[model samples]
Target: MAKHARPGRIDPTWPDLPDGEHPVSELAAATQGSLSPFGDVEFPLDDVPYVHPVTEINR
Candidate 1:
């Protein structure tokens, strides 16, 4: 029988991601360029110190 997947847990099948520290503004600027500027999406850049990755998901 197959085991049930648990909530708030990553599946074993998924690739492992390396953890590292980085400034939020740098990350935001890097990703924002992926979107079309003409579209209705915006990610304004701000110079801030390091932000935790887990907490950034909620933003």
Candidate 2:
């Protein structure tokens, strides 16, 4: 049922797994920060500005 089964969808699980000892390797030093989704290259956690809703009823 997954879209990867169809012709061009390459399942990047095994191949994509970073090379080196787990927990020991930081990955950035090995791959040269190629994998954006893995480390600091990833999108920063959004600090969404808080805006309280105005609940005052109009007279």
Candidate 3:
């Protein structure tokens, strides 16, 4: 279900970085002091119901 870019077109999902800016270097700088894991680390999942993909598809 993900949107893909055409053969010669840039993906809109990606950030439009300035010239000479490397993606790896930009990522490193963005998470420079991050010590926590990704996602909803602070959210409580005990009350959330797990829905199977097949079940969701049939809904």
Q: In terms of TM-score, which candidate is strongest?
A: 3
Q: Quickly count the clashes in candidate 1.
A: 0
Q: Which pairs of residues clash in candidate 2, taking residues 3 or more apart in a chain or in different chains?
A: none
**TM-score between candidate 2 and the true structure:** 0.20
Q: Per-residue lDDT tens digits of candidate 3, residues 1-59?
A: 98885866866677777997765543555355544554435456556667666644564
Q: Give the per-residue lDDT digits (tens) of candidate 2, residues 1-59.
A: 65445645655453443666454344535565345544564355577466889899999
TM-score versus the correct structure, for each prediction: 0.17, 0.20, 0.24
**Candidate 1 vs 2: which has more lDDT:** 1
lDDT of 1 by residue, 15-46 (tens): 55567744343465555445564465444636
The candidate 1 region of ten consecutive residues with least summed lDDT is: 21-30
Q: TM-score for model 3?
A: 0.24
* Number of colliding residue pairs in model 3: 0
Report the CA-based lDDT of candidate 3 relative to the real structure. Answer: 0.60
